[model samples]
Target chain A: MKILITLLASIFLFSGFALAETPEQKGLAIAKEDDKRDNGFQDFTANMVMLLKNRQGEESTRHIRNKTLEVEGDGDKSISIFDRPRDVKGTALLNFTHKVGTDDQWLYLPALKRVKRISSANKSGSFMGSEFAYEDVTSQEVEKYSYKWIRDEDYDGEKCFVFERYPVYKNSGYTRQVVWLDQKEYKILKIEFYDRKNASLKTLTQSKFKQYLDKYWYPEEMYMKNHQTGKSTLLTWTNYKFKNGLKDKDFNKNSLKRAR
Target chain B: MPFIKPHRAGWTLLFFLAILALFRFPVKVFAHEISGFAAGEARLFPNEALFPGQNDQSASFALQPEYYHEFESGSSFTFVPFLRVDSGDQERTHFDIRELTYLWLQEDYELRVGVRKVFWGTTEILHLVDIINQNDQVENIDTEDKLGQPMVNVSFYRDWGTIDVFMMPFFRERTFQGTGGRLRFATPIDDDRVQYESSAEEWHTDWAMRYSHTFGDLDIGLSQFIGTNREPTLLNGTDSNGSAIKIPRYEQIKQTSIDASYVVGEWLWKLESLYRTGQGNENYFAWTGGFEYTFTGVFDSAMDFGVVGEWMYDTREERATNAFENDIATGLRLAVNDAASTEALFGWVQDLDTSARFLFLEASRRFGDNWLLTAELRAFIHQPMEDLFFDLRDDEIMQMELAYYF
Candidate 1:
């Protein structure tokens, strides 16, 4: 009888251990859990702020006054005003981003007296000579890269889903990237970038998640650091709104000339 | 004797076949991009009468044609098939596609490939951009033809700049020879205006590194190159006088250079210095500075004016008898209403010697958004070299061209 009770206890413990998951499956489960946190969001408009820090320990803050108009199925557009650095107070940066095609961009250099088009295909280049590429400021869709479950771990007391993403674009400077999604907020908590040589190059971290819409969660602050170059770009978002009646006609090329 | 080896001839034949295989077959094993395109351009070439003894030019004509194309993203696989001909000279034709090759990018980030162009230069205006050479005339030079290798090369392109190693294995016949064993040949340039020159059993490899950076309002780049050229004759040490000349089958040449430039507002400044060290160690350096200012018609913002001046080294100096020398040249350009449908430009080139001058003028008018008509004229005046006084002629070189771009 004593032997039978001991055997039963052993079987029960073994069954519970079998139910415990591996790191990869745990990561996928956490990702699925996080995806459930965002379901009803369709459109959004927001004013964002950014704080930039250099490797020399010098810090500069930029308060961007802008209106972002994003559609549910279509891409997003932003008309931004540089409010700081008295020199560029009135300068504007306009971006007309598409879902899968090339994005048309223009910067009005008050000095050059002309609106110059940014024809560089390397959108992944450093933004304002910072660690973050221009693509990072834009929204992340589901189709830009292929993902695989990497591992499951606890970051800052919150269980996280870590997945590796490989860029599908031919001109991408990064070969692969690892993303950490929060289990409760579904927001991307961190990202590690691997360059073409499969070497770790940079990392992006998100902090201070704020719930804007009832169903949407957004990071109020973000930071990106280039491990190789020791450079970094920090961003802060403020006053985010969803579903403001912005139409397609407002994003026309002719409108770009009058954005300022 | 029956068992003896087939000797050097057999080895040479095998080597030639191996090189041919490297290009004939698409070694898909080597990763590369393959894209196709269609392009056509109609250029208005100015025409003029040749000197009395020289039959070089007569009437102006336009050559326009649509052609297929194959090109790589980088300095790799490129194949362009096109033909151009002039109306005045029906018998003379120009072939555009001269060199075609595939690339094999290696593991060390070096391009171990076949048929490629090695570029060396950093400024918007390149003084020593001589990796691949071309004719002085713009119309006669084809874009596909490079002063590069028909053989093989390994190149590394980094964010800062590039480094290239190359070898040219080909054979050609010598046509003309002068004193000091100096030789020249009538290069086999096709009607398409593509030119390629190679030495008998000759091989050459070029190695160079370039770095670029930006500081304050300036952009700077620096490069250094060293290489050697091997020839069967150079090693044979045969002199024109039938005496044994001590010449290496190969000779060494090294060039060290620096390019620095600054841009502030509407002004631009650029400088280049090159030091050549070898059998004839000659150091050649050139400097150029330019400034441009634009004024909109406070009344109509579209109207603008541009003025540019450039000074180039002439490379010829009487003091340097043991080495090749050149003279310096200065050019001035003036353009008005450049953004309008109808635009005009006048240019002048002055040789420092004051014995030679070049005058150039051109005009273009755009009809609607699709069609454009252009005409150009050029005149070369050689006061000292002229044996006959055909100072000027009417209708010397007149040509018109019409083009549509989509």
Candidate 2:
């Protein structure tokens, strides 16, 4: 019980309850509170559609199904199954995300009945020819980034906290990301990404929030626009179901081959 | 010589019955989907044919239709029927069931029954450990095309690893091109007159078990198979028409294999080795190992280039069954990360002892959303008279295929 008290005392002291808290401390406190609120959902399933558009106004689409299981002390485990474009249908990808180390990923090709291990260095690559990077769509653990509070602002007339977070892991495509979160519930509203040269690269807007189980809030749609490339991707999430009683056994390499 | 055994008809009847039984399962269907592709291909052989009754050009069409159904209890059934029609070779015009399986999946264990295709290997150039399915030689010379095998498989997922046990009751003979095909020997392969070392013949049961696990970045699999050898010994003989021919002789053998792949950063190192016994005094060991280094996002563009190299070695160097006794295979893979998903592979294989080499190029690009265009060029160069592939010296060809998927 003494260790528990020490942990609680640390969290209480660094949570900005005391005076003279630095900007970094307050930013970390906000992130920790946000992460805590989003925890304990157990498991969830959803259907996602990705619409990719190029500079010439051409468009293509992909259909995917997702299942995520929250892990206690590490990152969440997830699986994604492809269902569209005809050729790549029934392909599945399984991922094990970690907080401070390289993540594990595998891809299952239905035609070949083969599963291949993917390198973690490919986290920054485009996710199936879309504008969204692989890391962007994966689970976001609080320890993956370092945060600093910038200011108190209003996002569309609502009270919000604007902060800049630097990626803690190497091989990230971005130098820093400016995040806008609602101060009332700590829900993410928007983000601006800066490239390695410290130039504006992309902006992501998450809207159409809906509260599930009267506690967790999720966005129905997310749009990302790349400024220099004139390309964009719109992700639409539907059929969200939570508390599906998924177990750890459903997130292994064998599950990848059985995802279909 | 004799003709094809009477068991061929029995296998086909069993295949149809399996499909019928799977389709009649009692379950609440949550989803039903259908998708597949239809393709047309044309090939042109530049040089003259090596054997008589052979053609310099060929045209073919292929169709594959897939049916999938998922039940509310987390069980599924899949059916895929395939057919091909070739204008030059009558034997190439054939029909086969690619996949007809009913899968019952639980949290920790799963069961699969019917005709299915399973691949197990790590090396890129060769698939020494992938012995579950019979190669469809009429489809491609690379041995990548497979005919589904009838089996009952059970897999258990546990903390230690995944274990799969298979029971296959029927044996399948590898199909060969007819006399009119360009890539053939001076003596046609008499697939009809097949001989088996076992008295039980096609009724011989095959058993296989595999244990696979992942350790950090290293993934490995160890498998053992006791069954009829897929690679047959071609016994030289004469047909009833007094023509020189080769007869396929199947023998019962036992094999053990290990395949491993370790990924670090942009490098992937792979190895697959196998030891085959019970094949008389011809028991041998062979292995292939290689490394692939990828350069991703080259020059800030969404393009990936990978260099692959593998060295193939065999214990019985000159007397090995196939061509890769002692050889080196190198290739380059290019993936252009675009909306159309364009990709290309160029490779070369050379024998270490003789002046035999094979070079090939394959490229494919998606058109719109449902169509794909593929082109391939294969050439055989500098083959000595004593080389095993000497018959292929005049069999170089250029092929193009267009496929429409739905």
- Top candidate on TM-score is 2
User: How much lDDT does each candidate structure score?
Assistant: 0.47, 0.87
CAPRI tier for the interface of model 1? incorrect
lDDT of 2: 0.87
What digit string (tens of lDDT, one per residue) describes model 2 on residues B1-406?
0222335334654765755665566657888989999999999999988788899998999999999898887788888988888888877877778888888887679998888899898888888989998888888888889887888899998888999999998888888889998776677999878999888887799999999999989999999999998988888999998988999999999999999999887678899999998765788999999998877677777677889999999898988877898999999998887888889999999999998999999999988879989999999999888777788899998999999989
DockQ of predicted model 2? 0.58
Worst 10 residues of 1 chain A by lDDT: A111-120
Q: TM-score of the A chain in candidate 1?
A: 0.77
In candidate 1, what are the lDDT values of residues B288-333, reduced to their tens digit?
4343333322222223344545554524254332111233333333
- Candidate 1 residue lDDT tens string, A132-200: 666666545455555677766898778877788776654566898898876666788899988778999
How far off is residue A100 in model 2, in Å? 1.9
Assess the local accuracy of residue B183 in candidate 2 as a C-alpha lDDT between 0 and 100: 75
